[model samples]
Target: MKTDSTDDPRTDVQTASDPCQTNRDHVEYVGMHVDDRPVVLNLTEHERLAPDRSLDLIRQSRPGFEWGDTGSGSAQLACGLLLDYTDDEAVASQHYIQFRDDVVSQLECSGPANCWHLTGDDIEAALASVTGHEALTPDGGTPTPSLPVNWSAVNRSERTVFQRRDIDHYVVLGEGTEEWLLLLCAQGDRAYPAPLDIRTVPIEEDPAPAVRELVAESNDLVEPEENA
Candidate 1:
């Protein structure tokens, strides 16, 4: 799956490959982070389709458009968020709540800009909050699930899996409030540091109301669906 980023308003989509077609599919991802944690938000069109060659045409028009500052990198762009915890559950909880709510709201409501997926530990706590469930970890903190609990959102199909492995940015931020260490995820493996530019977003002070609503609605929705 190939993703394209818009200049002003960002959008996110997940496209799969098409066997009958001879082109690669295109999708967009917009990721937001509070402090370091990230949330796995909306994924559009999670089906295998033919790739749009227009993306390539846009680049060909501009000279050196495909190159980064180094002038010798692929056009692919990836993003990630990192959080620093004193190993304090309370602090981690605070960061997790805000990050989770932001992602959930984005998922429920259509975002005007593209939304990115949260792929690291900071957002894990938030996912736990939304699902109203907890995972047991041997270490003091909860364990990060190897895969996302929400199947449809994460694993759309084999086509999505192929793109997730092929091209994606993994960015890691530092531990401080506004600092982020950069990381990269290539070809479906875990993320590591990358030479790409890192973008750090500020964390919110208190996200109590958003957290409450997310948990309440999630719990309310899941019960009937499960029972039904």
Candidate 2:
């Protein structure tokens, strides 16, 4: 089910005084309650804004987008917005969860008839505030990391199958009974011995290729000093 200006009375026309007003270059995302269900639309595209499933490689958190609270639905919405706004999977993946908590969850609606709107600039500012980094451009030089890696710790039982130490980062591949855990850590004390990012591959598969890809794409790895 799609909602657009031509079909939805709530979004039929934009008022000149509306704060959500946008230009051709500015994309405006609108979310509202339709029959008690949430409906999101990209005002610039004039189409329904659906959640991006590709961001859910680790797990399917929710089937669609939602707002006004921090939950699986909000997480999905956050990922979708970041992906749509930045057009950069790496930037979206790195900060979507934080964006969800900082922005999406705060999009409170008064009732079923209530609505919220966010411009591309608003999203950019929110992302910057949440990540404490500069906004990402469409061509933001940060190369996309090889695969989705979770921010988690490694289990003590896992055996280190591969290890790589660089001037700034430490990467480890740990073999478990059913999976190979790939962990990237900082070189110094701030987060050393604890993974800043993690990826899991099935036990039946080889982890060497993944390790190589990750190492080659290590420029974006978070540094311990930066976090300290």
Q: After TM-score superposition, what is the CA distance of residue 93 in candidate 1 from its true location, in Å?
A: 2.6
Query: What are the models' TM-scores?
Result: 0.20, 0.52
Clashes of each: 26, 0
List, residue by residue over 1-228, the lDDT tens digit for candidate 1: 333354322222333321111122322223333232232322333331111222232221122111112111111111111122132434334233333334423332134333333333424555455445332112222222422222111222221111111134222223344332222223235464333333343332232222233323433433323321
- Model 1 scores a TM of 0.20
lDDT (tens digit, per residue) of candidate 2 on 1-228: 666655453543355555554456888987877766788878898777776553453132545778887776787788888888787888776677678778988996543335688888899788768667432111222232332232122233434422332244545776676677887665565654666678898643435556655655564553323322
Query: Which candidate achieves the best lDDT against the true structure?
Result: 2
Give candidate 2 regions above 4 Å deviation: 1-9, 12-19, 52-60, 110-113, 133-228
* lDDT (Cα) of model 1: 0.28
What lDDT is obtained when candidate 2 is compared to the true structure? Answer: 0.62
